[model samples]
Target: MTDSNVSFLGRISLAVGTFFSILGDGEFAARVQRLRSGAPVTQAPVAAPAPTPAPQPAAPALKQASPDAALQLLGLLQRDARFIDFVEEDVAGYSDADIGAAARVVHGGCRTVLREHFTIRPVREEAEGSRVTLPEGFDATAVRLTGNVVGKAPFTGSLSHRGWRVDDVRLPKLAASHDASVIAAAEVEL
Candidate 1:
């Protein structure tokens, strides 16, 4: 072979020898080093790394969702009035039972809508707080609920906690302001 070809073969051999040395089995290069009067070298058989148990991936941290998160969710719902449209308020009026059932649907659907919207799913629920106590890390100064849907008398008020559950919705008050009344007058077509 030419000098360049011979040199290339030598480099390939050196690279292969180094790879085996790193894998902790080959010692041919050690003999070559001895012949060249380099420093004596020995490897401690790598000890099979003492079977380090692969570090176990740190067991994946346990994530818990806070109750104040519910408020953020509520904020989103308010921002998107379309979600409220799901509750069907176009009818003339609804009975108390109808209002209660509608409330349950909207309230229960909040969490599911959120999960469908974002990542970072919660593995388990954190301890929920009462309406009086906002969740930790919650900044009231920055939070705002701007969307106000004027619906039938069944969608009003701030979210409130009933026992362990949070109920922030309320029925809309009747159209009985001092200026306006629900009484039949002049047969106005709504």
Candidate 2:
């Protein structure tokens, strides 16, 4: 199973959020680069590889992630919050108040599903904006370095985000006849 302890939905969320973090935060991007190259967390940065005129796409080599959990989670969200509808809607024509109201509904339902299905906790113990120092060899996966990162570790910085980790997942088991692809079945009034 390509599945680690994290659920498919959790990984998806992480990937999307990380994409934005990498783009806006140079320090976060640097840390990701270092980790990708198998460098130690405290090590000085490495020079970027020379770009080739033509680059080829690399095929994924790891075990495949099953879509069952992701579909199930989406079904839950759709059932609870009409999530698919909300996202699919063309909101450019809507007023701010209308959007805010819909967002509240989505947020509440999503929050409920997450809390019920996943035991999530902060990666750091220190309060955000507090000065905290990471000694040599901090867990790179858990705590990503961001903003003005330099030299070795024993690095001190203010916490911008505490970060979240899924401690446990409690998604219900799939039935023998379950169709994972159908995130939500169409309903009609009789």
Candidate 3:
């Protein structure tokens, strides 16, 4: 073969080798090698076909929370703490002092609502900024590790946040006459 033809053939051989390596199929690689070396490729003896797998039963559907129930809770928050008002307010026109004062009011109201209605507890007992070691088979839902997470646990990391969990919710029952969609009534002065 000419030098150019040999170079082209070498390129083709390298491409095929790379492709086979990526595929990681030993039988196909062996067959290709036998073909390239001008050796007669023999097929291995075929085993009898296995029986088909039985059909599996479908999983049960998950129950979803009512949208109105969520809306009622939001309405309750708006009524008790004026949470929607504070959040929806445009703070750009206000001074830092004014904003801070408003925030303090909002914080106090929200805290009162939470304390009265919900039983909240920290997910992690350890204090924030403390060093922690997560053993193997750790609960991924409760504790989320961030930054440079590699390999299987026993992962050593510092606690950045002490997450909260609502153990009990005791939201007040909404009246039949009350419309949950109406977060707050329009105000008017006589």
Candidate 4:
């Protein structure tokens, strides 16, 4: 995903608002970038046909985080008051026709967030996917995020694999209203 430098809260807010707009429009879906980086292999060359130069160690790879996961990360950030307020302001000043348009605009602002949050890009590409080499003692899990192209539902579905492996991270709860169908149904006795 292209780095937007937009904050996490802004992405969450935009995701929710965009969902509503798509529901209203019925012809738009959020665009997301799915990224993977390759890891470099370290090896020295062996002389065979003639005198061959030893292979030099390549720079560590930097992997791009999945855009949907990034949005989910934003959702997590929304839990904080300061972040919530920042997102609110970022979302409030927009005068677009719907959240879809607004989200596209905000998407452009997340460039820095993408870079900083992940903190590393794969220096090389591996066959399986991208590989990011962390510091000597860095320990982290991979976060797998699958984005559903269902109009504008804010990258619906599960987040797992590494990092914040949260399950069922949907936008309904985070959406502006709690009086939704599910909420209303849950209020009644089964």
Top TM-score prediction, candidate number: 2
lDDT for each residue of candidate 1 in 1-190, tens digit (9 for 90 to 100): 6655655447668778776564443245445566467655554234333322211123456799654445444445644433435433443467878867766766666655554555442222433332232343433233221223222222233442222322243322333332222122243688
Q: Order of all candidates by lDDT, from best down to worst?
A: 2, 3, 1, 4
lDDT of each residue in 20-102, candidate 2, tens digit only = 89966666788899889898768656667533322223555889888888899998888888898898786879999999999
* Backbone clashes counted, model 4: 29
CA lDDT of each prediction against the hidden true structure? 0.43, 0.82, 0.75, 0.40
Question: What is the Cα-based TM-score of model 3?
Answer: 0.62
TM-score (C-alpha) between model 1 and the true structure: 0.21
Top lDDT prediction, candidate number: 2
The local lDDT score (0 to 100) that residue 151 gets in candidate 1 is 22
Checking candidate 3 for backbone clashes, the offending pairs are none
The TM-scores of all predictions, comma-separated, are 0.21, 0.69, 0.62, 0.20
Q: How many backbone clashes does candidate 1 have?
A: 10
Root-mean-square deviation (CA) per prediction: 29.4, 11.5, 20.0, 20.0
Per-residue alpha-carbon lDDT of candidate 3 for residues 26-58, written as tens digits (9 for 90 to 100): 456667777788887786436565343322235
Q: Count of backbone clashes for each model?
A: 10, 0, 0, 29
Candidate 3 ranges beyond 4 A from true positions: 1-63
Ranking by TM-score: 2, 3, 1, 4
lDDT of 4 at 159: 26
Least well predicted 10-residue stretch by lDDT in candidate 4:
30-39
lDDT of 3 at 108: 84
